[model samples]
Target: MIRIFKQLLMTTLSIGLLASIVGAQGQQTVEAASDSTQATIRVDKVDNLSSDFIMGADTSTMISEENSGVKYYDFDGKQSDLLTILNNNGVNYVRVRVWNNPYNEKGQGYGAGNADLINAIKIGQRATKLGMKVLIDFHYSDFWVDPGRQVPPKAWQNDTVDQKAQAIYDFTSNSLKTLRDAGVDVGMVQVGNETTTSGICGVTGNDEYKLFAKGTQAVRDVDKNILIALHFTNPDKTTTMLNYAKGMAKNKIDYDVFATSYYPYWHGSLDNLTYVLKTIANTYDKKVMVAETSYPYTLDDTDGETNVVKTTDDIKPAGYPATAQGQAHALRDVINAVANVGPKALGVFYWEPAWTTVGGTDRAANLPIWEKYGSGWASSAVIGYDPTVTTSTYGGSQWDNQALFDAKGHALQSLHTFKAVYTGVNEQLPDPMLSDDEATIASLLKNPSFEETKMSDYQLTGSIKLAQDTPKTGKNALNFYGDTDYSADASQTITLDAGTYTFSPSIQGGDTNASSDLAIYATINGQTKSVKVAPLTGWKKWLKPELTFSIAKQASVKLGIKIKSNAKSWGTTDDWILTKIANSDTDQSGSSSSQASKTSEQSASSESDTLASSMVSTKSTKNDVSSSKRDKTLPRTGEKVMIGFGLVGIVMLASVCVIYFKHQAS
Candidate 1:
């Protein structure tokens, strides 16, 4: 009875201590959650003068949005002129992208503002009238050009490198002359839009430098006073993009400002951004700036078009919430980072803050207007210009949620982010969102998260396996990589009752180009719908992509991932989920909210199960006295705590046995 009482007392003490530790840990988590809202402007105007900092916005689609019947409003909620509102909020520079041609032979518009020289001049005139300097971004293509696609203008498709260079010079000189003739104050000219991947004017390699030089020459000849800028994207791959500048410097390419696109989520750390820009400024003796950057203020889809940022899981990737203040925090930090780069830094520009919905808020109502006004992402009219744009999968803005204005055009609080940073606008923002990774929903696919030791439920083909190198979550992820040209595919077929569902998976790493085609697809009833995963700049960069589909009746659906790449290309996909959302016609497990609760419970249960398993294993090892039984590598607290308790219990047992034996001997 005495020994049993002593044993029970020790056990109770151990339990109390462990419970205290756990409670303390839980309290700390809650405190951290609440403190996330205490965000302040980490860097102040100490980096540069307010007057010198260039607060700019890329209002490329403003004209199209306005023409589509968007009304502007001031902070006071009074309807006001857009330019006046921008100027009032301290925006001193405007950027407008100009394409060589955005229409077919029939003169039908290709959308994205139809920003030819005429519309660009008109937009520039508005900003210029408001005393704001303009940065003319020449895409040098007939349509939108980026790392993904850089098609040459139709008129220059047959031109050689030399011919294209001459065409560039002539086109630029004429465009600048026209802008000057229109009384627009042009402060800078971006020679190419995101030319980091390849060449301009449909050329690649060394020829790209030659074409860029001609564009720079044209800018100089037209107006030496105007700052000439070369723009690139993906500062995360600092080595690669820095090499672009080094290549230009090696080739004697004359340019003033070296600009980069900085999306907080897509790009790497801001410290890296500062380091790269600082190196370029000091090494090449050129000014640096963020040519384009923007963050979503909300995840709510204001327009009928799906938002670029669709999930709440995406909002805090950069450590900011999807609130108005969160947008401000992101923008301010980008400015602070640029300013932190020292005086050689020019400024930062918010991209397309005003590209809201056209016509009315409804998607159906906006379609005809988008078609009529060329206000959507890509109109059916662009099918003639861009072969990639199909009659379907076109129209509606993917950027409405990222706009600095709400869908109704009222300026978001983030609009003042520019002025606030310049004037040392230091204020506390709401804490960042608290997220639950253990979140899960009912799904048919086993080992859906790739958490299982083996690829049990998933069907694999060609170099497909679970990888430990890098995962978005957990210790393992589904990886696709190869040294030679290859097509790798992985799939899981599940039978489901009649229902509509959305499949979301996070994809990371790749060549940042589309030639290989990395995608997640779902096939139901002999019909397949696939969403292309963009090849990001680096492995560390991640994107949450979703694909939605519905079945009229119960059927089998094959959900999978496919990757086609040339030599030495790679990417990863993880955290698979297929959940039934609300629809007018459907049979689902439960409402989205109920499923969310269940998923939360499942996540928590999984965590609890792991904890319980560890504890049981620890308890089972109390009598494990063999030398090999002890694992010297103790990484978790429970095991260490249990070991300490075991030692104490053993010491007490030895004392009791010694006393009892001594009494018997006496």
Candidate 2:
């Protein structure tokens, strides 16, 4: 049942994304370019950019990409070095975001360009050779950092605030010295990336600004001429942005430039973007610039990893179409927006624009590459540092379609926007009519079917993964279990209004002879309810058992599949759903609907025992399974298991046993 609401609450955005493997997948996704010529997106230049206006692109991952054998081509399709291509397109600055350590204790690179000091050195050296300046963005964390997170490096986890400030100064000073030694033109240094809410080192508000002051002091000591920049994002919140700007002054955080990340998608309108920056510039007498901005040329997944902007609705926030020309217009307009803020506007940096497609349209084929080559946004190795790296959010780039280069590694028309902003693109371009899938559903839960195989929404445990052995319907199913006795589940939490809902989980795997138990469980408030599935007799066979429950008010509910199995017990589960069938103001125990739901659950359990017993009897007749009582079993999602031969064996003489013996053929 497809339930279309005003919006999808269950899936996407940073939340919408942690899950999605469908709506955009395999094959050439965007429509072929049109033969008829159309006018290229033109920009209304305002002072355009003086010789000092920064045209920057975050090519932080280009090293890993080039190492992976990707080649960069100019707009004309001629092979060229990346820096040279950018230079030809009027790009004068290269922004490189560096992490303290994006690796695990095993020393494996945690992908996402493995943004270590070494890569920064390599990129700085290369970009400087072409006369382009480098902006060294220090995230001050082992992994990615933004407004939501500010984990201090492990080495300084236990340090005091004063100690952290000193450590920040020393680290920044040493890193700048290293870059200078490498014959690189280090033009600017960013204290932190998007340090608005929680700035750095697990600190909040004023504490965050203090850390930035230490970093700024180090930059000033290293090179007075080098711009000391403080970066923040979200200009949409005028009051917040203004107060943050004022907070910088109140805290006396000395910095030369104030940078904001202005992605047209999530960040607010261009006018607001200008107003926020202009206020800071005029008030503080500090230079301002856009630290990051990007727009997708298409809503397709070029590398099988889901694209962040995978739907038409995504660009609606920015009012831009998903096309190469549309991408150019968005970028060009941003450049003009910053330039219009007077000469104090330093420039705009297109964040990771060159992070093009590195893998094919199959995540299975791409996951290993992501783990090894530092390609994906995050890797399994980073799970050590960032607890958020799950089976779904760990691998592959969600920003590929938004890259300046096409999936084929050729520069898109958007790349020329840097130069075209001032000179104006005179050529008539192709329409390149492109469209995306419903991409996102307004479902109560945010997730995908196995055919998508991305496993976008669920947090899986143990041996569970989307297996392609034999799908329940499409190309894959949720599979779990191994030779050893283990408990596994794929769970996702959802928020819903108070009402009665039915949860039905489809399952398959093994035969009636299997000793494993596959059940669907839902956790509402503090209580958990579950229903076991019937025995599956065929590899393609699937059984769904319904469990209904009620909540009195708006509450968070956790839903997922639970497996408790003996040794060598394995199973596949798929298409689990929770549907709200009614709305009543009655209590769960008093409502008729609740009673019916409980009765349905009991009926389903009775059927499971009857069918599972018959399958077991057939297997016993063939001498395929042992008659002795199995040892361990996982009953609920997090319930303790019975290891030894508990009283459960003696309790097996129920109707299930009676049915089993009657069906037995001696």
Candidate 3:
């Protein structure tokens, strides 16, 4: 009887084990399935932290929460303006951008862009006055922030890296203090608009870490405890993002939270955000926030102009209105999507919610930062029309339409939806991830393009034969004949060793209209010089530019050539020349005989000069290919080559002369 009972128990145990396996597999399959749908999202287990983010909504719904409900007294309108309702419901923060020097030299203040310190102060003051937490966003530039086109502010040019970093730090700390001084309680301060990704400060291809570290350090030094968020534009590559964070941490840099800018129009739907947030938060063990986010309310252009029109197709969901009601719904939905990510999800900041219609006040209109493609403007401001009574021929009040409150500052019916979203009590919507089964959402968090492939050393050779264009590589490479134009093909490396060399692409004055001239230039030590080449025809082996430049004994240099066409139009011929030669011999250009006789004398003199002079340019600076060391002396705009000699060749020849004199004494 005991043996029989044991057999039955074994059978029961086997069935139970099989059921557990099947259940686990089913859950995985369900998640995989949701992956196939656009709205389906997935969550990765990074931490056991509960993700209970506030899903506050922003409502630009025109006039009162129940504006539509009260139609002919059909229903009572909801109380409050959309934004206020969201704030009351649970929204924790609001972000706004401030532009610097938006006014032209004329001082005739441009529109809302002049959110100079004074303007920013007012906005912060108003937001705090309403008891809402304000976030100060420094655009770094007077415009937008993104991967492409993050030109530093114009005035900051010529400043050293330290100077620039300090400037940013001062601007941030001071601005934050200013807001606080004005009785405006600023909860967060974004050091730079969006630098969470790779291109933070050190000028992309250069010492990115060094430069960014300085700024990041500077900001922290100002207020160690303030929540410092590193904002990134892409969420897909958690590894890449983590790599950057690790690099910073290795250097002992500290930041409180990680933030990202995600727009479904560009990033994708709900699933993408959830995966990015959870993965990055768990990986880095830091808080996460959607620092800057937005969506168009309608497909219609308020001004009735097709060019300025916003389209749902530009994003998705095809029929979203350009109307107030449409915008309010879209706003509410996005907030809910972010909140569902869980615990580390602090909240979302609606960018420029009060960007109202003020004449000449469009940020993207006059500011190149906001302009996309053509000049018509890609106005992303929420407030669609003007609240002020002032009128303009350009439909000045267009932006005021997106404002949460009506023209009279009265609450709109859409406010009810915003409040519902924030309270988190509306409904426990089914997990967007639970419905997903496919894992495609993983793609959204992919890394930005990385050149993981190793590079190989190789030589690229070609010539600017008489009429053909020869591309120039290094600043020291020579141009042959009378050709001066050269294009740098995508991949080629020209290396220069310490020595004196001459390079010049010349041209014979043919048709008086065809008076073309060629000049070669070189950057050595820390200076550049150019020299005229004796004009010659194709491969005129006879004309050797008498170039004699002394490259510091252990220094490297780059070569370039400037082509001149005295014709009605410059560069009409479209041809260039390239040549490279390394001269390690200390001999003068006079040849072998000269070298043997003067070697010793030249050596002694060079020793003297080297001892007396501090390491000139190339002063132990690393020559990383990605670096951009602006020769402060390099003409801001390309300087016109005179006769045929440019600054580069002249400097090279002068150095050669100095070395020649030393050779004579030896």
Clashing pairs in 1: 36-431, 36-432, 37-430, 37-431, 440-599
TM for every model, in the order presented, reads 0.64, 0.61, 0.45
Cα lDDT of all candidates, in order? 0.74, 0.72, 0.42
**Per-residue alpha-carbon lDDT of candidate 2 for residues 30-84, written as tens digits (9 for 90 to 100):** 1112111222344434454787689999999988888766788875567889889
- Residue-wise C-alpha lDDT for candidate 3, range 1-666, written one tens digit per residue: 656645654564445445445544555555553342111111222232233442322222111112212111101234444434445544555565655554444453334344456766765565566677666666665444454335565567567766776777766767666776898666665656566422543254335555555556655666565666666764433344455556656765566667777654444345556766776677677777777555443332333322222322233221223333334444555565556566666776654343332223343343332221111122233112212212222222233444443433333333334344433321332221111111121111111010111223212233221111111111111222211233321111244555654433222222213365555556676586656544443211223232335564655454444454432111111112232234566543557455434532432221112312322312222221012322211112121222123333445445555654565566
| Worst ten in a row by lDDT for model 2 | 629-638
Please give, for residues 465-556, the per-residue lDDT of candidate 1 as tens digits. Answer: 66543455544567765535778899999887776677777666665344677778998878888877655556546666667677777889
Off by over 4 Å in 1: 1-50, 425-666
lDDT of 2: 0.72
Q: For this target, which candidate reaches the highest TM-score against the unseen true structure?
A: 1
TM-score of 3: 0.45
Model 1, position 538, has a per-residue lDDT of 63
Question: In model 1, how many backbone clashes occur?
Answer: 5
The TM-score that candidate 2 achieves is 0.61
